[model samples]
Target: MEFNFGWEMLLLFFAAAALAGFIDSIAGGGGLIGIPVLLLSGLPPINALATNKVQGMAGSFTASMTMIKKGVVDFNKIWFAAFMSFIGATLGTICVHYIDVSVLDILVPIVLIMIGLYFLLVPNIGDVEKKPRMQEKLFNTTVVPGIGFYDGIFGPGTGSFFSLSNIALRGQQIITATGNAKVFNFASNIAAVVVFVVSGKVVWLVGGVMIIGQILGAYLGSLMVIKNGSKLIRPLVVVMCFLMVARYLYGKF
Candidate 1:
């Protein structure tokens, strides 16, 4: 399909990317906004998904770096998780090139909805740090890699999953978990973007335009996370997760 790179279209998409980056920087599920905006702009589904990765990588990188500079994330502790996430995402992206994603269409939304409900119903779930129930190594190997693989293959609610895992299993404070989530999200996004770039699926013009907005939005959102802490992030995470569920279920039925 052919697309017109008009100023009007660019502005619309840039606005959408900015909003997506803001929400994604805090709690994930940015694709719920970005991909739909791309589709509405007349791109084919595959192209929309591929192009979304470019802007997503920009947003995640911006947020991750912002958190790092703010001293919210400790790279020494998270480097292993980040590396595992990158590897998992790479493998998942390769699998996507060969396999149908329809199966995940049903499964992923269910999981996201469940996660949303968990956060919504549980009181003070991530407000403060608690004693970890699982070993850090186990978390890096299992939860981190598994979520990274899911992010690469499915590409939504990854931030929520990462934050929830850190809070529930690793006993991290909500703000700290959100910071760490960005790191993993950035890793997975880079892996997916590389695959999309190699496959010639990215629309560089559109992606490049949206990336400017993504960077700005991500920086602002990261600041919000630092300022508002869990009070802001928790509700956003729950909302984003449910929004992802609705988006996917609508696509399915």
Candidate 2:
């Protein structure tokens, strides 16, 4: 594939990146918008995914920083999870380079739809403050690591999956859950970006522009979530889930 980014394409992608960054930081549907725009921009699938991760790193970093500053995360406890997520992401990237993403494309949407359906069916799910079902160490070590691996592998609905799992299985408050999710998502993206850069898959100029848009949008999304509450997050998650379903279905046909 010829690697050239026209100004018009750059501008259009920047807009999409901003929207994806904002929506993804808040509700985890950024890839739904970002990846499609990238594919439409005339890049191959792998290149698009690689470049998207580069931009996503920026958004995740900004959101993670904001959430940390706001005291929405437990840094000490989450550091281990972050490390594991990075490792998992690196492994995922290598696997993607070698394997086919089509199978994952089919599986991911099923998982996302199930998660979204659960959220939709349960009344006041995020509102309830409940104790964790699993022990903290076990959940962090086993549950979080497993999710991190999936995130590294597939790269969609990661934030929502992390948040929902934290809330449902770990029984964390919504704010803290989102904050920690950002931290891990940052790690996952960093790992993917490292792989992409090493493999020469990313278009730095294009990725850089997308990163700028992602940063601004992520900042705004963090602000909005802090101002609003789980009430806002729930609906957005549903929408993102629907979008994921659509993306997967389109890919199949």
Candidate 3:
């Protein structure tokens, strides 16, 4: 198929990428924005999804670097999780062609609503240090692969999922969770994007431009989150989760 994107679509792509990157870097629902924007821009369903993956990877990569420099993450410890995430993502990407995630679309909103409410009402939920129930090795081996599989299957709130799981289940601090989540997210994205690219499902020209916006926006978001600390990131996460819930509901029914 011949590829073509007009000026209006180009503008929207950049705008969506910037906004999604900002939201994603801070709270992790950027796909909810970027994906729909691509769909509305007139790309086919598969192409839109693939294009979004391409652009989204740029944002994830940028945030991962920024958080690493800030000492918010320890890659050496999370390497196992990251590797598992890649495998999960590859599996998910392969399944995307065969399975429809319509049921997951219905479930995401309900899950997000609960998550959003928790963040909104509970202060210091993720700020405090706590003991983990599972050993690090076990959690990394099990939970990371589990979440990565889900991410590949239905990827709306992967970042938030990772963050909350790490804190609630593994007893990591919020900043650390978010930072570690980005690494896993990047791994997942890399796997998915490769599948899309190999299948010729991306609009490289448009995706390339969108990636520029995503990179800049991600950098800004990382800076903002770092400056404000968990206090600011918490509320944004709540709002974005709620938005994801609404969007998922709208898409499903």
Candidate 4:
């Protein structure tokens, strides 16, 4: 595929990336904004998804770094989980061609809706830490990689899944969950990036500009999460979840 994007289109991508990064850093579903813009810009589906992953990784990396600097993410505890996520993502990417993903097409939106509802209706969820429903070791071993695998296969609400599971099962505060989600999401993204790069689907020029935008947007969003915690993240999570659902429905139907 050949892309000769002019300044106007370049600026448009940068704007979309910045906005997506900001929202993604806070609540996930940045792809809902980013992917459509990529497609609209005339890249084929594979190139768009591939290029979007590049920018997405940059946003996740920036968000993770910001949170890590603020000491919200515990590197020691999440290191193993990140490794598991990487492994899961690699397998999922390789298996994507072989697997039947139609079930996921139906199930994921329902799961995202439930996650959104859980955050919406639950009082004081992720406000203060409670006794964890799942042990940290078990959660890292199972749920972390499970969500990573899902992301590699069909990514849309991966961030929400990470944040929600961290909060609901692991009993972390929203700020903490969001921070950890970035690390896990970044780990999962690495495997996908390698695949895309090998297949020559990525557009480096578009990805380069978008990376700059994502870094800026993710940094600002991370600051907001650090300052406001659940007050900011909760509402965005709900909104992003619904947006992800709509994206999935539109694609499928």
Candidate 5:
């Protein structure tokens, strides 16, 4: 598809994608920047979403690879979760064509607020790994798929959900959970990108430019997560969750 984006608009999108990648690599809500920027550049909502997926995939892949190379992600433990998440996202994408997601418009913001508050109030929740309250099998089968479905259906805080579940249920340290979260996030993103590609909605030129920014931003953000650990991730997670809540509320009302 041909787009008439001015040079200034292109630069704005590049900057936005960079910022989105940085935030998403840390806490996941990159769409907040990506989708809006695409819309502002005059694309329709569906095209914007599809194009955002392309850029988001770039960011997620970069972050996931960085975490893996840094030895922060445990591939053996996350393989099952990643597979389940991919399947769940594919199903969710199919379901979106038939189901009314407006129900989530109200529910998701409430859930996001609660999640943000939970992290904010609990001073030391994700500071260190704890004993598992939920088994790996249960978490992989239930929590992983559920969050993946949510990402496919109505994505905003998927990363935060994954990280929180890993910490609260599976006894993973904050940094470790964030790293593992990227694995599943990448899987789900790939699933979404496939659907978008088939539908022919992706704007390759714009996506290509944004991807360059995504790569650089994702690399830097992953490094921060590796070095700062929970000290950096916790606050960012909380902030992103609240931002998601505000974005949803704005969209709804």
Candidate 6:
């Protein structure tokens, strides 16, 4: 369900997508930027959201690949977790309506606020590795699929959730943690895109335009993260989490 907007409009949205990708590469919540622009471009809400995922997948892929090339992340290590995340998201999509999201809708923002606070309060939290609170196998089996399921069901803050899980449970530094988060985030996005595409809700024309910008921005943002580490990541993650909290809360009140 693609719409025929002018190149001028497409360019405007492309810039927004680029900004989204830049922020998303550091933290998560690119949708906080991309989705609004898509909506403003006159697409229906569902179409805008689906298209945002389309472009977002591009950003995630770009950032993930850049990290892999830079030796910051080893895809081989997290392959199984990525697979589990993908499968969980697919299942979550299939079971979307069967699950009651009312509780989740309320519970999620509160959790996001707490996460935001954690980042703000503990400045040195993710700068270096800490003792793992969860086992690797256990984290892979549980948190990976858990966040992926949440991604499919509610569709926001998946990256921050993944990054936090990696840092807190896997004892990863924030930069590497963010890179690992992108992989699973990409996997979950694939599941989302598949479901959205099958439902014919995506506006590919808009998505295609935004994707170019996403790629460029994600690449640059990933480079900065590589150079600067948590100094760049912490503030952005903080901003994105609170922004995500605001977005979710706005839906309620």
Query: Which candidate ranks first by TM-score, i.e. highest?
Result: 4
In angstroms, the error of model 6 at 192 is 1.0
| Model 1 error, position 239 (Å) | 1.1
- Lowest-lDDT window of 10 residues in candidate 4? 244-253
- lDDT by residue (1-253, candidate 5, tens digit) is 6787777877888889999999999988898899988997889898999999999889999999999999999787689999999988988888988999988877888888888998889988778789999989999999899889988887788888888888889989888899999889999877789989998999888888899989989999999999998888888888999998888788867
User: RMSD of model 1, in Å?
Assistant: 1.5
Off by over 4 Å in 4: none
Which of 2 and 5 is the better model by lDDT? 5
Clashing pairs in 4: none
Clashing pairs in 1: none
Query: TM-score for model 5?
Result: 0.97
Q: Which residue ranges in model 6 land beyond 4 Å of their true spot?
A: none
Q: Which runs in model 5 stand beyond 4 Å of their true positions?
A: none
Candidate 1's residue-wise lDDT over 125-168, tens digit each?
Answer: 87888999899999999888888888778777788889989998
* Stretches > 4 Å off in candidate 3: 96-106
Cα error of candidate 1 at position 192, Å: 1.3
lDDT-superior candidate, 2 or 4: 4
lDDT of 2 by residue, 1-253 (tens): 4678779988988888899889888888798888888888888888898889899889999999988888777688789888887777777766766777777766888888998898788888767669888887877777776767777677777888788888988887776777788898898778777877888998777788899999989999988888786877888888889888887788778
Which predicted model would earn the best lDDT? 4
Q: Write the per-residue lDDT of candidate 3 for residues 1-253, one digit (tens) a residue.
A: 7668788878878988998888898889999888888887778898989989989999999999999988888787788889998888888877877987778765777777877888788779878779997888888777888778888887888898888888788887777878888888999888878878898998988898899999989989888877876887898899899888877777657
Give the alpha carbon lDDT tens digit for every residue of 1-253 in model 6: 4368887998998899899999999999999899888887788898988889889999999999999999999999999999989988988887897977778877888888888888889869778888898888998898999899888888788899999889888889899999999999999889999878899888877888899999999999999999999888988888889989888788779
Work out candidate 3's RMSD over C-alphas. 1.7
Per-model root-mean-square deviation over C-alphas: 1.5, 2.0, 1.7, 0.8, 1.1, 1.2
Score each candidate by Cα lDDT: 0.89, 0.82, 0.85, 0.93, 0.88, 0.89
lDDT of 2 at 253: 88
Q: What TM-score would each prediction reach against the true structure?
A: 0.95, 0.92, 0.93, 0.98, 0.97, 0.97
